[model samples]
Target: MILKTILSGKHYQFKSVKDVMAKANEEKSGDTLAGIAAHNMQERVAAKVVLSQLTLNDVYEHPAVDYDHDEVTRMIIDDLDPLVFRQIKGWTFEQLREWLLATTTTNDIIHYLSQGLTSEMIAGVCKLMTNLDLITAAKKIINEKTANTTIGRPGTFSSRLQPNHPTDNLRGIMASTMEGLSMGIGDAVIGLNPVNDTVSGVTAILNTFNEFVTRWQVPTQTCVLAHVTTQMQAIEDGAPAGLIFQSIAGSQKANTAFGIDQHLIAQANQLGKQALQNKGQNVMYFETGQGSELSSDANFGADQVTMEARCYGFARHFDPFIVNTVVGFIGPEYLYDAKQVTRAGLEDHFMGKLSGLAMGCDVCYTNHMKADQNDIENLALLLANAGCTYIMGVPQADDVMLNYQSTGFQETATIRELLNLHPIPEFETWMEKIGISQNGRLTSKAGDASIFMEKESM
Candidate 1:
């Protein structure tokens, strides 16, 4: 008797095939043991009965044995966990396959799988599915998980104020923000990628935005994209800590460079909860991308996709309000072209949503990439279909500060119009009140410039 062991995070050992069969039967019996026994018997008898009749190639190319639909169904029913079989017993294989392909909610698939399908079994079946079928199934899971575990208020579309500028130039920042606001954007939070990382620099940017809010009376929050430590200091110094922004990577060393770890993130979250006046508002904003671990030389031998998922896991611990994956921003070294960009965007969104993060996509690309505006547009639409929480609303799809072309105000309008999505409830009200957006239709007035300039002197 040969001992066979299956080791996972822990270990399970069986003294012999009979022991394994007995254990399986004890847990829940079906064809599992009987099928194995029969297969073993057939293998042993193959040499004696068919050895003289067939060549090596024929044996290798053909199945060991053929089973009709009834036989196959019987074998599956026997091996399946009793609960799973019961759930699926009434449906034929074709019907079951079709139902899985057509199902739009992940909860249904998860419910079925939980009935008794193992991960290995699921993966094996997935190998036979087309890419579209696989993506549809993944989207269902993401949708269900996102619906249940989202951080911020649920049931509304959100957008961020990514007003980036060189030198933290207030004029450029304000102009870009006004452009977005003119088109009725900036619902998530008005966040800035500061040129300076100092406490004073961050404080100045936050103060400028605070003054803007006071003067304009826009329903929004503010953030200066600095390290959490600096932002925390600004908060201590009485700056409005609307949202704490940080860039995160998969590995500890990479995160350390950003002055963050799980402990620091928790501390910052608590600080944000105390500092910000809004009750029940999510205050953490995290930025992650596909190649950040590899670019930081901290991948630790994992592939980029796995590393990206790990970053999402790290961000989820903080119950963040927003997690944006800067897809395609890292250039072609990581993700080569349009296809790579689209897949990475979908995968990142899917993984983040599954892990219960409020997932958004910066449907963007650098100038040096092999991709173009059409690629960005295609990716944006796909993400919208997948129910992405938000997207970067840069001016004319260009960010001078980051030197990348991302989704613009026009794309935002197009997406909303096409999908009939509205902004978050509060911002939607503000837009409707101000006549910028009415009844889900966005309109711009000629005096929009005067509104900002009239208050500029204040």
Candidate 2:
């Protein structure tokens, strides 16, 4: 494959496919910190020029991590439909990009083409897309998965209500949960990032969530973002978990740092299926982020975009109920500022949708980063327009436990109204019954958490 190109009378030479992938990416602090990003704009364009001409087969042959050495690479390659791959193997990245944007490419067509794509090819095409290109192409694809209720249906927007407290206080957590549900959020899930990751602590929280959801007849799933083993143990001890949750990485070594592997994830899925029988078919929820592999020293010298795309490729093997990137939570070291964070959020969402997963974004930032609530809100709106399946809904967009800012419950409610979107059909019906919403808009009673308390008294 050609890794050399000329741009505006300047010559640029990339050392490898990996090098081309890194340099071609739009500006990211992680890439620069990794010492792989282009030194100047001219070289960045030059890298893109060279990458645009590379064939799908060229990328396929040079997996970011060798198949022999990495299970993620193997899973990405082995799961591809051989028949579909043959038809598109010879197409150049430029050709693939144009075809995706062509009027002839319908959602069904793009979905079919996705069966043949490897993560490397997906990442390669992603680097060549402009910001609007990312939005336009992603908007055409709808990937839906069901755990307790369905998500990603057309005209639907959803939120994962995150009732996280600095301490795992059940009353405080429930207060937040009631408020979030009253605002017409939590249709996607009511998951928590536990302050305590122990089996007992996780089980207690899951049991409380299960009881509340059951009593209120909330049509959503509940999970505690504990380690996979802790969750498994909790489930084994009879905790009612609708979906098993884990944080995945793009490389085997990074996954190891997260204390997971394909075998472990597969085992968790099996346990989750048996536990959640008759509830839903898709039983796994995965979280990923750009720069995670780099953070763990496991990127194999690949760019964060390529590494992040590999995460989707790995995640698809399990047919996860939801897969979202915790964009910006990794802090300024990887994303730097609002512009970089916004770009990564868009790229990750687009790449995840193209990989055929129910995708969401955390739409968040750190206090130290050069960003504010406005930047997170802007990215949230963009992703919503791009057909994102769900986003996190923390109270006032602040997670005291996780120590970051994300999309708030009120923000989600407003976005649903502004975009003319509704929650999952069943959950929306439940909201109507409770007088929290009517005709897809929040009612006067929507903001009152005491509604549930009144019901409890009755």
lDDT scores for all predictions?
A: 0.62, 0.92
Where model 2 places Cα greater than 4 Å from the true spot, the runs are 455-458
Q: How high is the lDDT of residue 52 in model 2?
A: 96
lDDT tens per residue, model 1, 1-458? 22333223433444332233223211111122123211343332322222222222231122111224222222322444666545544442234335556745455455554334322123222323344554564455432212112323434556776889877887888888877776776777778888888999888888888887767677766788888899999998998767888888766767876677767887888888788765554778889887776667665443465457657656765667788899988887777777778777877776676555668889988887778999899988887776778888887788888899898777877888888887777677777776677778776651264446663432
Output the lDDT of residue 26, model 1. 12
Model 2 lDDT at residue 123: 96
lDDT of 2 by residue, 46-121 (tens): 9999999999999999999999999999999999999999999999999999998887799998999999999999
RMSD of 2: 1.0
- TM-score of model 2 relative to the true fold? 0.99
Worst 10 residues of 2 by lDDT: 449-458
Candidate 1 whole-model C-alpha lDDT, 0 to 1: 0.62
- Angstrom error of the Cα, residue 189, model 1: value is 1.5
